[model samples]
Target: MQKDIYVVGMMVDERGSKAPDVQQVITRYGDKILCRNGIPSPSRERGIITLTMEATPEDYQRMEQDLKGLKGVTVESIHFSQPESFQLCENR
Candidate 1:
């Protein structure tokens, strides 16, 4: 099956209060994550995190569900085709 590239965006309000918990959740799913970038709002009260990953629909849904359960957090995701698959190539 072909896998699409998924980009997940997460926003956390009251970041100082919620960052530890949020980071824990993100760490739990670290294996599935290809790359991650996080930025804080000018006032440092809010944070935005971006993640690029490869996962099955089920896995993605599960992750999203977990994140959504967190208070003061919002999540959004977008997926699209890419020229390459996330799978590693085998030696011939």
Candidate 2:
């Protein structure tokens, strides 16, 4: 499978009402998401979310598009075509 790593940033301007819609979009791409982190403002009227996703380029684009389609939501992404292999540990 051709997999790329994606870092998605989402801003919810109207958290109270837009949150449910944003949640739905995120849920639709649940399997592709590796990690999610969300931060709500002090007043809780806005939220910022970051997501790490492992999926094909097409899937990432689809997700980005879905999020962008929502009202009061802004989305952006950083994509890296994952290398074939990488070492996660250093030699002892």
Candidate 3:
């Protein structure tokens, strides 16, 4: 049996961000982040980024701490999905 974990987060950039900054953040997280979407504001003073990540217990713990340390970035909300059982398929 395997455990399934999900972390959903809404991110705000207090100072706003350029395309490169958002790209860097995605690159930094790499494969741990399963999906991400961005909404650009017409005001150009704010941007919203939503992230969905597949996390292990350890990964979740680490990101919770590390996300706050991101410069010019704020985490608006974080939701941890209820634990679920998963079937593991081993081929070999």
Candidate 4:
């Protein structure tokens, strides 16, 4: 089976209310994550986090479900596959 790339976006409206919990869950799935970036709102009332990963369907679903359970947090994900003819110019 071909592996897929997933870009997950999380928005938390309550600042640090659930950030630690979300970070814990992300850390648990660190092996599957390729990149992670988080930015806090200037007012510190909200935060935006992005995670790029490659994981099995089961693992992906589990992660999504875990994130969705957090209060004041909204999660969204996009999945795509690289074209067979495409080639990576550098190793990750």
By lDDT, the best candidate is 2
Q: Could you tell which candidate, 1 or 2, scores higher by lDDT?
A: 2
Clashes per model (N, Cα, C within 3 A): 0, 0, 0, 0
Worst 10 residues of 2 by lDDT: 81-90
The sequence of per-residue lDDT tens digits that candidate 3 reaches over residues 1-92 is 22334545545565354545555656666677767777877676667777777656676566655666666566654555544554333478
Better of 2 and 4 by TM-score: 2
- Which prediction has the highest TM-score against the true structure? 2
| lDDT of each residue in 21-66, candidate 1, tens digit only | 8899888888888899999766888999999977667777888888
Global lDDT of each candidate: 0.84, 0.87, 0.60, 0.85
Give RMSD to native, each candidate.
3.3, 3.0, 4.3, 2.7
How well does model 1 score by local distance difference test? Answer: 0.84
RMSD of model 1 against the true structure: 3.3
**Candidate 4 lDDT over residue span 1-92, tens digit each:** 44567899999887667778988999999998999999976678889999999777778899999999988889999987766455434688
Q: Looking at candidate 1, what is the lDDT of residue 88?
A: 41
Off by over 4 Å in 3: 1-3, 14-23, 76-84, 87-92
Candidate 2 TM-score versus the reference: 0.86
| Error in Å for residue 90 of model 3 | 12
| Cα error, candidate 1, residue 4 (Å) | 3.4
Better candidate by lDDT, 1 or 3:
1
| Candidate 3 minimal-lDDT segment of 10 residues | 1-10
Task: Compute each candidate's TM-score over C-alphas.
Answer: 0.80, 0.86, 0.59, 0.82
